[model samples]
Structures are given as structure tokens and as C-alpha cells.
Target: MTTLDNGTNSTPAPTLPAKPAVSMFAIGTAIGAILLTIITAISVGFSLGEIISNFGRKNSVVEGLLNPDWGQIWSRRSRSAFIETLQLAVLGTATGATVALPLALWSTTFGNPNRALRTLVRSFNNVIRSIPDLLWALLFVTAVGIGALSGLLALFFFSIAVTTKLTSDTLDGIDMGPIEAANASGASLTQMLRSAVVPQILPSYTSFVLYNFELNLRASAVLGLVGAGGIGARIEFFRGRGDWEKLWGLVVMFFLVVFIVERISVTLRRRLI
Candidate 1:
């Protein structure tokens, strides 16, 4: 039995090396972010104190809020001014969005039959967007002699910038399979877009248009500051006359309009998105 046991000698199992512990990269990042936040807080606190001390001497902030002019808000002229602002926003948004649809399609690679054409269209769109709407309003006011037309023109261009960018992005993210299938079935570019892409992105496009309308509403209210014809002109008039009561009413009206538009936009976005 001993002779038989000597024929087979058992070997020990090999030991596997342990893995090194993971580094605390996440913790380090957190610490760095905390330090940055502390620095930013200190800077903001100092700036806020300076602002408070500067404004405290005038006492305009307290007087403005505590005793707003409710009577002036109910005046017929004020109501008319508010209506004019709304009309300007609505017209501008409608016109801008309508024009933007074609431009958006042209700007996208998918809609462009030729690569060079697509590049050109995209560049033009970029150029248009680069110019601020207020500047456009100023130029138009100079040309059109300071009226609602100038405000309308400004809002229209602004809407185009917003709508085209959003629509092009939506077109870019669409499912390619449908596009390919439409092409395979001998669909024309117009047919393919109408049948495949438009249907899919219509909801998002509508939502964006609505959002732009809300923005235009706010813009129209200020367009009168440049003599573009809206509540902004009234605000300027009251301010020039030193009628703080009327000015306060205009401010309240502006706030109310903004709040209402925001609420509607939020509700519509929620439903659409």
C-alpha cells in the first residue's frame, strides 16, 4: 500500500493574486465641485450686498412693489395697448413659422438633394440666426418709420430663427428606416417627407411653434421701446412723464401676460412631449 501511494504525489493549488482597490475618482470630483460652489457662493454674496446697498438709498424697489397702480391697469388705453401687443405677437409668430417650415427642410441634409445646396442653405440659416432680433427690430424701425410693422418684422425673424433650428434638429433625429423604405418604393422627395417625416415630427414641431409664440408675445411687449408699436411705447411714455403709477400698471400687465403665456406653454408642452 505504501509503494502504491508513492506513485502519486499531490500538488498544492495555485493562489490567485487579489485585485487592487479602485481609486476614489468620484469622491475627488465631488470635493472639487464643492469647493467651486463655495467660491461662487462667496462671490455672489458680495455682489448681492453691493447691489442691495446701492439700491437701498433710492427705495424705488420697495415703493414699486408695495403700492402698485391697480386703477391704471383697468384704463381703456392700457387695455388697448395690451391687445395691440397680443396682435403683433400672433401675426409675427404665424408668418415666421410658416416661412420657417420650408427653410428648415432646405437646411437639413435629408431634404437637400445635393450636398452643396444643403451646405449653402445651412450657412444662410446660421447667418440669419447670428443677428439678434432686437438689432433687426432697430433696423426695421429705421426703415419702416417706427410702428407695428417694425415690431412684426422683428418678431417674424426671431421666430424663423427659433423654428428653423428646432425643426431641422427634429428632422435630423427621425427614423431612417421609413425614409429608406419610401425611397425604395419610388417616392419623390416631397412625397417621402410628407408621408414619412412630417407625420412623425409634427407634434414636436407644433410644440416648438407654440413655444416661439409665447416668446414673441414677450418680445412684442418690449418692441415699443424701440418705437415698434406696443405696450413698451406706453411704458416709455409714462416713464418720461414720471407717472410711476401708470408705469407700475404696465409692469403688472406685462407680468400677468407672461405668466399666462408660460402656463399655457407648459401645459401644451406637457401634453405634446
Candidate 2:
């Protein structure tokens, strides 16, 4: 309130800052994205009507999912397959994660001082990471005979990519004081990393390894479909025979195993972190 010369009180009008204008670039980008999506959908012959019609039909897959043969889990063959899958996951994670630490270190600036070598390693990591686990399974199956060996190899590579990528990220944020001190003390590169770097990142790295194991366990089932040997092979067998009930049952069992293992992994990781 303000007092006027005439001794009358007066109030000033409240004011607000003006809203910022939306950029044309953002609007254009949104419009372009919408247009691209519509074009891609049309190009792919996407049809909502066809989808609805198909869903309305008596689909055996859906029926199988609805009424799965839970008894499949009790079969001796299923038990064997489950064991194979577990073995694959364990072996893959153990081997891959073991090597991943070195690969991760070599890719970093602190770990690998040579810029060219670091770039090469980074490129290699990127290429491997780009390939999905299924593709890796396919490649190994082609190179090696289709069996548990192929699956093991695929999981090994997949685990390395996952663990190395995670460990590298963790390495990036570590305290550099110990590293500088190690360098000033004339420590060797290996000694410096072991003393300064390894201690700091061990917990996070272990957590990543455990996480990688969980992923490997889940991926093992899919790897078997390509004849890499695991529960997926059994799943493929049931699928080939049109035994959707049995397939669904195996799927359910796999899910349960994965869920339990993931819970255990999460608990361990939480403690480590």
C-alpha cells in the first residue's frame, strides 16, 4: 500500500514475469517424429483391424498360456535341462566376469595410457556390446558345433560386455587422490591399479558381476533355442512338437528360477553396494 499526497491509501497492481515462448525447433522435431512414426507404420503394413481380428480368433498360444501343463516341471528331462542351464549361467558369468576387469581397465584413460590402444579397446567393447546375446549364440553355433559349448561361449562374451561396461563406468567416478599418490610414489602401473583403483571399485565391481550372473541365467534359456544346449533346447523341442502346454509350463518354471535367483542376487548386491 502507498499513501497518496491527498492522504488516501492506494495499492499497486501486482505483476508477473512473462512466460517463455516455446521454440519452433522443438515443435518441428515433435512433428517430424510423429510423421516418421506414421510413415514407418504404413511402410510396415501395420494394421489395427488385422490385430483385433487375429486376437478375436481361437489362438492356441493364448490358450496354452491360459492353461499350461504345470506337470512338465516334474519331468526328469526338465530337471536335467534346468541343471544344464544353471551350469551354463555359472560358468559363463565366472569366466566372463573374471576377464572383464582387465578389459574394463584397459579401456579407461587412467588404466591404459596409450590413446590409440585405448581407442581400439573401446571400439572392440562397443562392437561386442552392440551384438545381442542371441546373435552371439548364433555366431558361436555357426563357428563351433551346436551344443552347450556354443551357449557357454555366447554367455561368456555377453557377460564380459555387461560386466566390463558397468565396471568401467564405476571406475570413472573413483577418487583420484590415491591414484596420484601411487604415481608420485613411483609405483608400477599394475601395482598402482591394484593398490589404489581395485580397492575402491571392488564392491561395485562385485555387484556388477552378480548382476551379470542374473542376466546370464535368464539368457541361457534363450541360448538353448539356437542349439547352444540348455533349457531352451527343451523349450524348442516342445515348441516343435506343438506342445504349447508343456512349453508354457517350462517357461513358468524358468520364470520362477529366475525370480528366485534375481532376489538372491539383489540381496547380495545390496549388501555389497
Candidate 3:
């Protein structure tokens, strides 16, 4: 407010800040998400009545899960299958993730200057990732005659998809300073990537590889259902004979192993980051 002495009146002059603008895009996105959730819920038959009606009914699956044998681990076959699963996960992650590092690097503009090459690499990665792990297992099983080799092949491509996608994303956010420095120092593309880029994303890349291993471990169990190898085959055997107790017992034991591995991997990943 300003006082006008001559007229004995008060006059006020002020400026008000404008309100913040809202984005239509954000509003549309929220609305779309809510609608999608509702549609999905309806399509999946989500209902409290359905859940209540199905609860506590006696069934083979429930009974088996409840009364697990808990001694399947003592069987020689079970032990061998567990070891094979471990081997498949380890070998698959190692080989696939190793290749993924280079493939991921090549997908980026900084690491690979050629736009054509980058597009090709990304396209290949996308194609590999589009195939589900089980489908890959089935395909390999058909091609390779249902063995550990087939399982390994499935896990390998799956690992490539997981690790490369993660590593490539990390590459996008790396410190451009070192990249620029390397370029100024007349470093070759390979040298610049190795010295500047790889070091920046190494910890993250390794953590992703460990995470991929955990996933591979779980998938390896299922791959055996398609005869790709691992304890899944043993599980299928028990399942075929309607030995619910043994099947559930085997599943429980296998998950326990996976849980332990995940714990270790998670710990290591934490340290890495």
C-alpha cells in the first residue's frame, strides 16, 4: 500500500507471481495408468468372493506343499541335479555377460561412432531379449536333444539380454568428462572406452551380472521341464508320478539354494555400488 499525502488517500500497487503450469502429458499419463490398472484387474477376474470361495479347499497341490518330504536333498540324484543347476547358472552368466559388456559398449554412440553399427547391435539385442527364457530353452532342447548344453544355451542368451540392457543404460549416464579427455588425448575408440567408459560403469555392470545370475538360477530350474537340463527334469519326473511331496520338497530345496546364492550376490552387489 502507498499513501498519497496530497489527496489523503491510500493507493496500492503490487505484482503477483503467476501460478505454476500443469502438464497435460503428466495428467494423461496418470489417467492412462489408472485405466490400465482397472482394465487389468477386471480382465484377471479380481474378486474378493472368488478368493474367499477358493480358500482352504483340500487339493493335491496344497497338500503336497503343506506336507513336503524335506529329505529330497539326501538323494544322490537330487544332489547331482542341484550341482548341475549351479554349473549351468554360473557358466551361462559368465559367458553371456562377458560378451554383453562389448555388445553393450558397441550399442552406444560414444563407444561406437558408427550409427549403422550401433543400430544393428541394438536391433540384435532387442531380438534376443524379445524371446522368453523358456522359449529359448524349448528351442535349444529341440535343436540340441535336451541336455545341459541346451539349458546353458538358453541361459546364455537370457543373460546377454539382461546384462547388455542394464550395462547399456548405465553407459548412457557415465561421466562425459573422461570421455572428452580421452578424445582430446587422441585415444582410439577402443582405448577411450576401455580406460574411460569401462572404469566408470564397471561396478554397476558387475552388479547387473550378479543380478542376472540370480535370475538364471531360478530359470534353470524351469528349463529342465523342457528337457534343457538342471533339476527341472527331476522335478518333472516327480510331478509326472504325482509325487506331490517329493516335488514340493525338491522345489523348496532348490529355492533355498537360490535364496542363499541371492543373499551372497546381493551382498557383493551392495559392496560394488
Best by TM-score: 2
TM-score for each candidate, following the candidate numbering = 0.80, 0.93, 0.86
* Candidate 3 segments exceeding 4 Å error: 1-48
Per-model CA lDDT versus the true structure: 0.84, 0.93, 0.92
Instruction: For residues 1-273, write the lDDT of model 1, one tens digit per residue.
Output: 443444464634444555657669978899999999889988877576788788777665456656778776568887788888899989999999999988998877677889899888888889889988778788899998888889999999999999999999888888988888899999999998888788888899999999998888888888888899888888888878877766886788687868988898889988997
Model 2 lDDT tens row, 1-273: 123432453546444545679899999999999999999999999999999999999988999999999889789999998999999999999999999999999998999999999999999999989999999999999999899999999999999999999999999999999999999999999999999999999999999999999999999989988989999999999999989999999899789989999999999999998
Tell me which of candidates 1 and 2 scores higher on lDDT.
Answer: 2
TM-score of 1: 0.80
Ranking by lDDT: 2, 3, 1
Task: Point out the worst 10-residue segment of candidate 1 by lDDT.
Answer: 2-11
Error of 2 at 184 (Å): 0.8
Candidate 2, overall lDDT? 0.93
